[model samples]
Target: MSKVQKPEKSDKIDNIVGMLMEYEKMTVDLMRKATDTPILEQYDLNAPYAKARIIKEDGQIKYRIDEVTLTDEEKKKLKEIGELLIEELDVDIKRLGSNENAAAYIRKLVERIIKNYKIKLTTDSLDRLMYYVIRDFVHFDKIDPLMRDPWIEDISCNGFGIPIYIWHRKHESIPTNVIFQTAEELDKFTLKLAYMTGRAISIAQPVLDATLPDGSRVQMTYEKEVTRRGSTFTIRKFRERPLTCTDLIIYNTLSAEIAAWYWYVIEKQASVLVVGGTASGKTTTINTLAMFIKPNAKIVSIEDTSEIQLPHENWLSSVVRTGFGVSGSISEITLFDLLKNAMRQRPEYIIVGEVRGSEAYTLMQAIATGHGGLATLHADSAEAAIHRLESEPMNIPRPLIPTIDAIGVQTRVQVGEKSVRRMVNVAEVVGLDPTTKDVLTNDVFKWNPKNDTYVFYGRSYVLENIMKRHGYKHEEVMEELNNRRMVLEWMVRNNIRDFKDVVEVIRTYYVNPQQLLERVKREKMEAPSGGSRPA
Candidate 1:
């Protein structure tokens, strides 16, 4: 008998490919069945896969999937489809004008490719392929879903071959399923992102900072030469409608009473500084409190990136421009320069997004001249905020720190397994303490972590100042505050939390306080006596 011939190398490879295809089919079927479960529908797949088991490892609660992956064959097919579509379309996705247009075009193009190729794929597999294709071409690549998730505070990629991490609104920081597996891929992706920001990256300039098309702030490191890792990028997603005072109340970030007090204080033209560290809700708090300013006032807001959204027609928003050289000047304009120019514009309320560097001095001087400034600062507490102003970079005189009439501390703290943002403290800058050479502040609101609530510690000196300035009696002030509180509660109860609706209510309060209050109270009383509202 003739010896049996050994299987050819190509035959073995073909056998392996056939096995992978079978595996891919099984995987697709299982995924479809898994997704069809009722529980999975309620839990958004993009939101950290909430239904999965969460393990406590490395000081974080990480959601883990034991077994779920794409086979090499599936990945190869996806790559082939993507390339074919790009070749056939020959159109720049960025120039597609709107996401809706791009999405429509992509859907039709993908369907055509599927029909022509006659590929054997399940409905679920086709859907998955379409998502990846749209992500890579029409959106932010692998992190597109995370970018669209409103609850995601941040999207951070450490480096090539590393898993991406995200800061979820509920979960603090969790690892994601997305990754950039190669240096060339990440380098090219960052360059594309930089282009979206109207900037460029290269060996000469390995660092890039930009604001994306959707207003999110992006910072990226080009290559391994600049970053120890291959490449990295972080995106701080922007909120279309920055949280309003009523939203803070609804979220329990602050109490209705505290919001009312701030409303009165802002109405009286008192300056305020919201203090907190990184990822704290300082900007959110200030942007919300800004709604308290009179709608007709001439408000000038200055910042490096445009984050504040105001409904006032008289508002002038200004953003600082970076210079041509790294930290150098070509046609550069700084926050300090904007503040100086704002002074000339005779703005009734001056809003500085953050007080970093010497701009603090000009802001304080503006506040001293009764400009009614509102700003945010990075600090742990009220005292630290004052110290930051008086210290090196800021160098505002000790006496001028008091010009900031109120300090609101926004703290992002871990409450059990969930991360929650709360206004931990609100203090009125009474005056300077002669004995201790410190900024004297009267603590008005303090957070009780045990109860997970904010409690009033003392009467607000800012409120008293407002009362005296407006020539309103103590009872009158208290009555006005109670009326405002009632309206706020009604809004929260009825879920009138949109920024525009909140602004409309506030504006109505200014034009016709009694009318608006009566309408709100009527709506509240007509509703059932008891209804569940978010805490």
Candidate 2:
């Protein structure tokens, strides 16, 4: 009835314009809410900023990380906002509990700045801005993505203007597009790394060897003091979940039989040493084998940088500390000191991250004293490991060297256009020859490169000793080994590679072998035929 009188055309137009303006405002508000959420919480924003792919260049396989391009205007805006945020922000990133929390806090701060300045930014632009801000503030900066990449094992920057090199798990070492364009930029980044590790680096203290919060090992040199080319840094990314025996088997690093053998000897309290060249996975092997120790055993691990991750509840991890003041004035704790201290702790097992300097002698002594010792050494073969033990710095006597019950030699080799790690040889330290005073080793497992298969030598002195110690007959020991091999194989087939899950299976076996074995057999029979064996 009231609409009998028609409204003016100008009024109708004004009403339509107001509705359009309100709709636009509502859309903008919704977009702001979505963008303001922590990038870590957003599935789309959480995707890896960069991806790596294998490309053929010059008839050779190459690893390439896709580069992200930003417009000049975007970069200019990013720099301005980054400087302002750094100047105004007062939060200590380390105390933020986790990367997620840090990201959320930084996002809130960024939103505050945006609102205060009334800066107009699209949702996509805001996402990019938040990612970079969180990355620079919470992670390793330019190398953060490299660190986040699970395939990258190592990252090395020689100096400024040099491309960073990354050791891809698949491609081995390859150069990356990321580089520090100037000496000052590299120096600043190196200092930031040192700061992240809670260590100081300067002209006075030019060297920094420390463990990052995420357990990665970082070594840095400051300001051309120790390094000739400005500043340099190397990061050895640590595996958050240590490799399990099942994982090694799946990777073909070793045969299931070798893993079973390790399980048997390690359970019998036999000492072991993993030997390999740099980046050949010595520490990884040690970590995997160390999982075989009894769950309740008292274990003490000493290291310069904490790299070993064990599931044992009774484990004590000790790291060497560099003292303040002068080198001689303030006594610095060394591996030898920690080893001696660990000896006093009455631990059943002593794990040395690596045997170097006088610590090797102490480790051998601990092994000779009947303390189960597990360590890693820089050597390519069992014989070389023995030689290094007998040489200076180690100086482990010939008789004491036999206390090391097993030596696992790991090597990186090229196989059909790919680089892989393999346990080339696993030898048991039988004894020292009385006449020649030479260490006698019995090869238990050898890797055959022809077909990339591992050959069981059919004899293991360590297993024999384990059988004797446990009062098991030859047939019984053989059966036990076979059962363990089957269990490991089943795990590989079933994809039970998580460290905790693997350990649970192992502990279950230790508690009730028959139960676990029966379950494994049932599952193996039910599994698909194609998945019965590891690739």
Candidate 3:
């Protein structure tokens, strides 16, 4: 029997390159198999170079040639090529726009370098070289594919040697295959992310909290001394377009009745406070509720980080700043400072994204002074929220609490195997109990956990307050509520849930309520039977 000879590395490379050289000419399934895995489908075929693909895997995860696992020697070569590209290529990165354009530019520069150096390689080797070059210089390296996956809501790495986990929109938290096994590799990647945020991280300032290039919130620990587990980072991905009232309606977060109640309350310039636990979608609920604000109202929003997005033309968004440099040359601007300054702006509506400290006191005072205020707080229930406010750090006077006309309690409930966020209660602040000195709230709407339905309790002091404030008759207020509910249903029926579309309809309603009502009625009458209605 003749002994079989194992193919050498050079021979394998030559064979792969020769095969690729004729790949374009052949007419077959364009599927390229490497090892045992295969590239199932290309995301962007028109791009100048290779794009990512949905690997032929069970979990529907993605893979890219640039992000594939490499051996130690291959990594060393990739590093050498990356260094050479940085030294020889003087391409202006600022001129680049999208990731595709940047990748194309880098590929062209690399091709020139290869020719100038008289480098001879197969097509497959050339592709491998380009992958590392683009990954290090043009893209976000290993995490690029994760960022491209639209279903991911968050990316979290506890420390080196641990697999990265992602919070997917549908599947919830899931452990990914990607990981950094060494502290040096993890530290370098963390610093790269920090620099991308336009910030610095070091032993002196061993913490970083900043927004990434794509507006994702990045919070990191720099060294092992601070974290005790090497470097760590968490990225809360940003939604390109925020959720709207119509979206909440479709998601069953809130009923059209609750949304319409908020609309009428906001139109009357009443204050509202949203309370929820961490990751309970408090900010999202409030952001959707802000859509109820009159389009022409002058609005000022203050936050530690910029999150709220409104379609109003007369809006000013302000973000707090942290001190910088050795001596802290740049003064740190606190949320309290922003709130106090926002009051002087004479805004018709004031929005505090999240109140954590004395800023809550300031927000409450603003509401008491009759500034149509809206804010979110970390609490589980309405009473818990009030207790937090009246407690230390956020010591709002008990009497002044009623200035917040309504409190919306958002909760994350476990339904079957999944967790979902729901607006459990929309309570109207009735008054302070004279005997007990506690807040008296009338629950206008409450979530029934048994049936997973939002039930109307009809306890609406908010309507009475609106009547007193707007001087509209009871029947007129009821009619307005019914009409607005119909409009919301009409929007859901027509799938008009885009932020801009929802804003346009609401603004048009403000301009001509009768016309808008007539149009909505006509559409509702023409809809298929068994559609959703106000709860």
Q: Which candidate is the best by lDDT?
A: 2
lDDT of 1 by residue, 175-214 (tens): 8657888989899999989988877787777887779989
Query: How many clashing residue pairs appear in each of the predictions shown?
Result: 0, 0, 0
lDDT accuracy of residue 8 in candidate 2: 88
lDDT of 2 by residue, 269-339 (tens): 88999999998999888989999898999999999999999999999999998877646237789899999
Candidate 1: give the clashing pairs.
Answer: none
Residue-level lDDT of model 3, residues 134-164, one tens digit each, is 8677767777677767667788999988878
Q: Whole-model lDDT for model 1 versus the true structure?
A: 0.83
Q: Between the candidate structures 1 and 2, which one is better when assessed by lDDT?
A: 2
In terms of TM-score, which candidate is strongest?
2
Q: List where candidate 3 sits over 4 angstroms from the true fold.
A: 1-77, 88-105, 121-128, 325-330, 531-535
Task: Give residue 525's error in model 3 in angstroms.
Answer: 1.6
Against the reference, the lDDT scores of all candidates come to 0.83, 0.85, 0.81
Whole-model lDDT for model 2 versus the true structure? 0.85
**Best-first order by TM-score:** 2, 3, 1
Clashing pairs in model 2? none
